[model samples]
Target chain A: MRSASIAECGHEESNAVKETQLLDIHDLVVHFLREEQVVKAVDGVDLRVKPGESVGLVGESGSGKTVLSRSIARLMANAVIDKMSGQVVFQNTDLLSLSERELERRRRKSFLSMVFQDPLGYLNPTKRVGRQVAEALPPELSRRSRRHRVAELFTQVGLPGDKASLRLYPHEFSGGMRQRVLIAMALASRPRLLIADEPTTALDVTVQVQVLNTLERLHREQDMALLVITHDLALVAELCDRVYVMYAGQIVESGDVETVLSSPHHPYTQGLIASMPGQRRRMNKVDGLVGSVPNLALLPSGCRFRSRCPHAFDRCEEMPPLMPTSTGSTSRCWLSEPEAEGEDPS
Target chain B: MSTRPDQSATAEGVSIAGAPPPLAAKEVSVVYRTRGDFGRRTARHALNRTSIEVNYGELVALVGESGSGKSTLSKVLLDLASPSAGEVAYHGKALNTLTRTEMRAYRNEVQVVFQDPAASLNPRQRIWKCLASVLELRGVRSQLELNEEITKLLTGVGLNPAESFARRFPHELSGGQQQRVAIARALAMKPRIVIADEPLSALDVSVQAQVLDLMIDHQKRTNAGYLLVTHDLNVVRAVADRVVVMYLGSVVEMGDAEQIFERPQHPYTRALLSSRLSIDASKRRIRDRPILTGDVPSTTAIPSGCAYHPRCPIAVERCSIDAPEPRVTGDGSSVACHLAE
Candidate 1:
């Protein structure tokens, strides 16, 4: 059923859906064992998603945003998992500590749900759209009951409810509709957390807006916490409340979305916002800073962004820990810290 | 026809291209015949009686969404795709009517830079080899001559020292650098007209700015006319001298860039600009929801009169039964709309 107008639903009721802490992650690290060395894809990142608050993980490609989000869902295979260490607390149990069989048993219900970038990749080509969503139903449901639930979900995500339409393959649906099918499947489980990584990136601008609106409305009605991963800062400005800016496998800045986007303290965050097309044009023709993300296998010595930072100094040679600024937001930059008195560069 | 009051008004609407020679396309149309889902052959008009002109050193923007036929027009102008009808005339010579030898001679005067740099280059070829091939095709033989031109071309596009980048391959370069190489390749021929097709869409937001600035500066320095094709209005506002707004393969509005932005007469143009989500957070909160009801219709099955009528928020009966002729609005914008008339 359609929820009441979003404005009518008081913030208290919206926040009161079991007041669940969906995923409590700390010191999450994913490393790959190369022939010569270990490369940390995700390093020392901590994240927490409450019941109904959606958090956006904003970063460019190769910023480790995708890898970190994927790892939480246990989508990465054991063979591909080189050396992972972290406490992934889910549903009152530390998921990282659970045995394979036990975690698999618990994963379907209370752990998490995910919508990947390529909707076709997540959806089976040969399988009927209804069957894909129905498979997420618990084994306790009989065949008829499962089919009935799938039809309800199809209508929930704004798809036609006709059984014949549901029987068609994934190719029959448009890109936006395929994404809706993926969302329907994710919501079928009614999991506490939903991780959508670049869900609307592939669609056109107007379609992207429509899909994002659907996602936001669903988050409110379902009371599901969301993790929206995307490279588009403009999208995050519209949808997200809090944001974490990642760079070189580290959280460079994290704060209220307005604070981070409007007046970002970190240099990388500033560059990212300034780099947006409609953001203030650069005073100089330098066009903000330009440098490729360093190869993950061969990271920089310290303060990974220092190589391209305009404010880099001698102190940046040492790795600056992720610390709070005067604004109370976390930023990992030497310049963000108030220097000791009488330590003058001039 | 010349003495009529309407003809005098139409003459008043034409803007002058301040230059030695005027570059223009006359009744340019591109039609493709394709089989329908049921195997019925149908004629698809990708571009419909479109005409565009750029002064000797003007930068004109062709703005349209996908299937609006902007790229098809670009390809036709670049001599890559032959139009079913009409002609592209530069300095009074029709491109379609030119002999093979004449076309080859004209190719050097009009070069195109494609959107994706990765797809534009031959992956196996070294950067130097690619640059050398352009010079070779133009009948330049000496190594010293090739080197001098290659260095100048690279440096012109902001690839400094030239030698460092000349030895690299397309894969070895970054996205911005690859685009620079593409620009360099286009400039190696010293073309008078540069047609860049959605050049920044594939790039990151910041890199897009840098590359667009580079192209703009190049245009200013070389005094070459630019025929830029893109769906982005923000880019058009920043770079275009005159903007031509297209909807469903027809020019719905055309005017000075700032004029169009300030007061768009066509509903399509108004909706396109207002639909974009502004980057400024305050503006995002303040602006009302866009009034665009649905997606652009497929080009294959265009509406009877105005292709945009079905989705037009303020469409009138005349817009559905009869196509509105291009008329000059009071604000100096040319619009094809019954309401505007």
Candidate 2:
């Protein structure tokens, strides 16, 4: 039914629904336990990414978007997490149920790969960048073939494939070049799904555009599903066909990028769209949402965003379930309730 | 307000008409000598002969990508870093010519807010101390008076129940709150000029609007000139009265915000404007946008002639041979592009 609804949204490629979902997350909740309190990082998020589809998870710093992505990639340490209950189904197999050895095997097979924000921190300072990428390549092949594969990956990511450039250390390359090398490393495995977390946030705008172009082209040619996790709505609008707006550790709204950005129902989503600076011609003052993200440890009852939401009212005191709105998208807000639609809740 | 010395009017009195701009960089150039490969010393021209000024009641946005020398230029204007070949004038008087007392007064008049609030603030001190020290330096001494002033400062920045926020350490607050505290510290001096370098870059998008609003609100109330050095054009479009576009250590374009946004002449400015990803989903896709290819060349090896000619879309033989001088167009916008009509 979800796939059918997505198909009805008039995506360019109808075949997206026919293919099995590359990744489907159900009721994912990740919480960290401190000395006494539990940090409710991700509280019940349901996300889906169809094969060859680019999905974006948009949220601010404390919105649990990063935690959700880390949980999806199974990068979280078991000891640190106090409560984690979710079904992370990847290509028909539940990733949560897999043993460490089995997961390692799957990771080696390149079923999933992730590129992080800080490229310099991820790359080895002493080792040549090309060798680092070559190491991520399958060890079964001879070193000569591995080097050839590394060069091919470099070319794919719009980086220089020459031997001289490959021999340089991480410090020698620019920030954008270093990020491309990391992307090349992630691409070395030829994974079906690529999870890029704030990939271009560290680089300059011009460099950022270059890196984004490379990612867009790679996504097109490789036919890989992309899950871009970022705070930038503009980036999501540019890259993803579908988007999920997360707020205070929960998905507030989910729909096609066009519908969600254009006619958002959730108050948090509305505030986010309005808060974006560059949308209007000449705005004297941006009507940014008041207050900050609620403290996860001591969250207020009912709607997580009520304190900051301008349109929040009595109905928001109770937690609103994620329900389908008239716009064919799901929104977790009382304003989108069928009977309450088209009326000013405030 | 009347008790404090009027530094702008008193300093030098060299102005023919009214007082000069609060802070101005007149053809300032900064070069750094660094150890290169094999222990060789190389001179990196971080800022070319760039000129910009912040008036008493306007926000001037200095925008550029990384390595464009926007940060270096901001430092030069703030008098944190001295220019190698040019002068930074504070109220019509050159900084070099200022007396000891005059220099101290200049420091009080011009306050700065850095990108990372956490780094700028003292982690060991409570929020109130961070603000109180600056106030005490300005001659607010009594404990009761200090508390009153700190409360007013904290409330002004939107931290409610200012007493609680003042007691907490910097680490206890979020990035946004810390930034607000940083803004409060800068405001404590009642500065005539504020130099904020990438103040919103470290903040979350939602929090950025609130902080920007606070800064603009304070600027209007105090009539303080602001030199906002940032890479985000959208923020520039929203708050800046005037815009200064920098590219490869040079001011590629300078004009009214509306003129720069609506009808940019420089190719670099055009590219920068177009390259910005719009939140409007109906806008053109990344593939369709005219994205400038290649990273900014290392400042150490800046290309000869027009620094932007190699990446510029419409470069001719003359552009590569001779650098184009800045020319004011009929619209009153200054552009340094050779092909700009």
Candidate 3:
């Protein structure tokens, strides 16, 4: 387990291992020009999601989680993404290599799909939900068959499956039901993988529970890989089998949710977990990280989190790799490096 | 209703019983009349016979789902919108019939910090300009006095080196900084009651903690009561002394924060506690707590009877026919569930 890393598992033992890769994002970099500054939103990130797997990307607002998700979906044409380098391999083909027309064709054929945070905006207000859900399906299907399929999808997502529901407008549905409608549309394409970005952030606790249950049920029944992007680590623990903790546009930690969350190795991850209120009986005064996320364009020379990290040392002047910890989680910190210091100051 | 600045009760609950509560909404009900898609008009019951009071130096959290009338109650407290049925009182005086001058004083006494600081702060105005506009009410004559007061306010909210932040526009500041400025503006009036409507929900996780600390510290420093309207239970647990849970515009449960969290009586309160997904080890074992099903009924067509009985797992047939009145429970909490006892 000492050499167990994403890079090692992806490259060194790739040929022998038969864990079907649904989507492999290697060295993904997303840079945007904001006010003449080239903000490196996502810098050299490597992530993988296999078939029937559920992975989470948890980060704060400026951590570039949204940008990374949009970058993978190739939906950032208008976002002014100056440079998007790296490979977004889906199933067998590199999505970055495909032309606009080819990408559109592939996307239409339903290799993958996405559900955004705002269902009110994603759903058409004037049109009936049944038509919108049916419209997401390939046009080759007969109109009657599409309606039947939409109803089935609606049932799968736990919406009322009656014909009356098909006639309802987007404005008539509740926020949670509208989100379920969007999910129904996302599943209409029958994609092999689904990316939901902050799907429940706008909802209440009870509604969030309903939506999460829907996503979990979908992941279990359909077997489509789930990539959930959110700032809520608690939601991540509930839905994801594995998780990636992102900070300042970098994957600081990644591992199974059961092990990584219970004992997060990275300082940033530890601070994030502690900051959550109501998790403990007493409000642990050991308040979370001291400072906010660093500016992307003006990032520090060493680790981006060094400025806010509590246990910084001289060795932290150099960036640490995402190495495996003894706890089976890959952490991007010098403290987690077993051979770095003999005394184990941490 | 006993935890005021001067008066104290049994010490077990935050009952503001004898304290002519600094800010309170008594039997407040707001029904907005809007024309529907057809020729017919409809009524939306945003708040229905809801009463919430905040003592001079207390932190009362109004916790509920989206359409649970939390925002409407905040508005009633802030005097932003007048309730149709009942009255809001401040300092033992009914607010609905107050004179213009008295209302102006009330406005200054009760300030608000909104959810989106960016939207609340004027984008075209600099931080100093925004702060100065609020200070003008105090009649600060000299430029030096104005500058000194503005800087002091900024520093009070933890934005140090205030001169630099003063010159910057709202867009130039970060979300957390903008929120700090908003809090500073609310604090500038030397407000007695600050109605913070989901102040930390827009902030990032780390920044959320810092902002929460600032708000709590502000409450401690000024003895200014806070009516915190938020859905985040974590925020409630961290700072709120009393917790009020609303369901479809009605107060289903209200009690001390510890009693509400540890031993929730109402089925809705219990469901809300279980629905929370925290970073605690106990969260995983919450599978036994039944997750209430069904969407929250719309405010326009609030359910009859218990309002929660449609989704309440323990609801009996009697629940749907008769509305349950709030009653005192053993935990020193007031629960509206007929089966709570």
User: Candidate 2 at residue A321, lDDT?
Assistant: 91
Q: Please state the error at residue B161 of candidate 3 in Å.
A: 1.5
Give the best candidate by lDDT. 2
Reproduced native contacts, each prediction: 0.22, 0.73, 0.48
> Measured with DockQ on alpha carbons, how good is candidate 3?
0.50
Which runs in model 1 stand beyond 4 Å of their true positions? A1-20, A33-39, A138-152, A162-169, A281-286, A339-346, B1-23, B35-44, B99-102, B137-140, B285-288
Please, what are the lDDT tens digits per residue for candidate 2 over residues B1-341? 33333546455443455766667788889999998989898989899889888888889999998889999999998888999998987776788888777788888989999999999999999998999999998999999999999999999999989999999999999999999999999999999899999999999898999999899998989888999999998889888999999988999999999999999999999989988998886778776777787778888988888999889888898888888889999999999988999
Q: Give lDDT tens digits, candidate 3, residues B85-119.
A: 98887655678666677677788888999999999
State the lDDT of candidate 3 residue by residue for A1-346, as single tens digits.
Answer: 2123344557656642433577889899999999999998999898998877899999998898998999898888746778889998887688888898998898877758899999999988899999999888998998788888988999999998899999999999989999999999999889879999999988889988888888887887777889999999888887888899998889999999988888888999989987887676646242786668888889998788899998888878898889998878899998887665345556
Sorted on TM-score, best first, the list reads 2, 3, 1
Q: What is the C-alpha local distance difference test score of each model? A: 0.77, 0.88, 0.85
The parts of candidate 3 lying over 4 Å away from their true place are: A1-12, A17-19, A139-144, A284-286, A341-346, B1-17, B97-105, B285-289
DockQ of each: 0.27, 0.74, 0.50
Q: Provide TM-scores for the models.
A: 0.87, 0.93, 0.91
Instruction: Give the Å shift of residue A21 in candidate 3.
Output: 2.4
Residue by residue across A157-242, what tens digits does model 2's lDDT show? 98889999899999999899999999999988888899999999999898888888888888888888899999999999999999
Q: What is the C-alpha RMSD of each candidate to the true structure, in Å?
A: 5.9, 3.6, 4.3
